[model samples]
Target: MRLERVKEILLQQVEKGKLFHAYILEGKNCDHLAGVFANAITPYPEDIVYVEPDGLSVKDKAVMELQNRLSMKPLEGSKTVAIIKEADTLTVWAQNRLLKTLEEPLGDSVIILLSKNIENLLSTIVSRCIVFTVDEETEITDLEKEAKLQARDIGEMLLRKEKFFTITKKLAPVLSDRDRAYAFLDALQEWYHKLIMVSMGIYEDDSLESHLLTKERLFSAIDHIEEARRELNRNFNVSYSIKNMLLKLL
Candidate 1:
């Protein structure tokens, strides 16, 4: 969903007094999105509390501290907004403790949890909150979906050791346009992210691409594609740069 659209939806809930006690926002720009949502819901600065991990993880102490602060009456707005950045970094013990807060929410208070990936969070935590997965642009996401299909087809061809001419034939449309080439690269990046998640055992994908790529290989591929994209931005020949990227991948 677009950020503005999600904001509107939440605002509607607020207007109707049907606001959810908690929300789980997961996406690449979720941190910024959460900040914007927090401000939109609670304009009063004093009523908003932002909690982030100081070290590797948010432990029991941090959750307890948040609870203590939340216990106090709001000084301004009727509702206090609490945003937990990197909620995935919360320790298992901390999540258990935080679960109590979710189960029995403070009256008229709202909690927003921001995470790049919801796979890292406990099932119970996710189940309690309304989840929203968002992208920066709905238009770009549609393009990415189309570009992603092209990428997958080419990937399958490469894995099959198809002739360069055959693969290049498949790349004709993507390489013909600079914007399409960039979108193609962006689609590969999406795959790279999934590969990382697969490596972490937090996500499952039965695609051949998942079985064919190692994290190191995927990272190197991303680097090559990004360099080619930089070249394209520098006014390099679109077809040549994209074809060169394919060569490097092969």
Candidate 2:
């Protein structure tokens, strides 16, 4: 289901007092799931203590904060809600620490973890949660479509790298927009990773132009790929990020 729909359901469940103690919301629509929860929490501000997992000072520190907040009666009349984003990135100790609170949550307490990949989550945590696959099936569908389209485009470009550079030059219109530029570069970086995996026989042979991204490009710039993501997070210049990554290719 779409994030909007998921949010509606969550809101309804909350109203009915049937909200799960813990939820594992999974899918590519993570941003949407967050939007739903964000919107729902608005009317009941007093009850919810939303924490952006990354912003927490210590690893799993948000859990302690959440437990502390939920320890008391929930804001006079409202129930307590905690939403953690990119939850799969959480350390093992963090999940272990949260197990007890999740298992014996107060009637007024509810926790939701939003993630793209749940395999990284502890099995104990998974078992205690009502897992929801948001875009699981949709990912395969979208990936198939994306593979076909991007493969064809990249194949033509790889054959004539010079021309492709010319095409990318046209992106000047959006080079100034940090968000769009970051997105463009991120996609390129991810595509290169998939290409490396493809070369390693991790991907289907039938996948198009699996050989387009050279192994040199893969190994030499792996560090830059990570740094680019960090740069984007820090709100660095998008055009600069893309240019630096592209330099490694040259």
Candidate 3:
């Protein structure tokens, strides 16, 4: 789910005094949002218990400690919130211990499991919690925005049948910063995805670029951008990948 949607749902739940006993925050980068949600649900720091894995897995000892803590009353607030960071790292034994607590949670106690990869978690445990997937686009930085705009301009130039050298020159600045290069590819991916959507009449946009490109070409663009992203992830030469992607896209 989108971050905004999750926030809205959380707000509504809070306002109605209907917050769930457990929630699983899952996404590539949802740690920050987990912290935010933790604070939002239980404003008092003393009432919020944070459980972080000390090794490859959340040890049984830690789970036992958490269970003991949860058994007590809230120190200062109406609720006691436990945020288990990297929840997917919970060992089988730890998970079983947690499952018992989740099965019969204390009144006004909330357990927030934050995991980047939910597949590692037990299905039964997952079933007990409301899940929210954080959208990475929600945390776009200023640098990423600039890179995205530059990438869109490059796409527009390619659609205009501009010279390859000119387009390559336009991407020189992005090549210097690895983060910007990845960000540019991400932006290109989004751009082509939107174009594909527009072509299918599933989305409405005023961009003439989308109207001008054929569905086949838009699909090809998305493929090339995704390939570039993979190359970047593999530590390929930035300039070469960008040039190759532009050549294929054009």
Top of the candidates by lDDT: 3
Writing each residue's lDDT as its tens digit, candidate 2 over 1-250 gives 4456556656765455455567778876676665566446445667766666565422577777778888987774566677777888777778887787876878767787887776667655755565555644334454344444443454335435545366457556435676555445434544554455455443333654535556555544444555665677688877776556555454
Cα lDDT tens digits for candidate 3, 1-250? 4787667666666666666678888887777777777787778999999899996878889999999999999899888889998999999999999999988988879898999866577756765666665667667679777976896798789888899988888888887778888778767765665565455444446874344577556655665766777688788998888888888877
| Model 1, span 170-233: residue lDDT tens | 7888878888898887676556544544554534467743445664565566667667767887
lDDT of 3: 0.77
Error of 3 at 53 (Å): 0.8
lDDT agreement with native, every candidate: 0.75, 0.60, 0.77
lDDT of 2: 0.60
Worst 10 residues of 3 by lDDT: 195-204
The per-prediction tally of clashing pairs is 0, 0, 0
Model 3 per-residue lDDT at 185: 73
RMSD of 2: 13.4
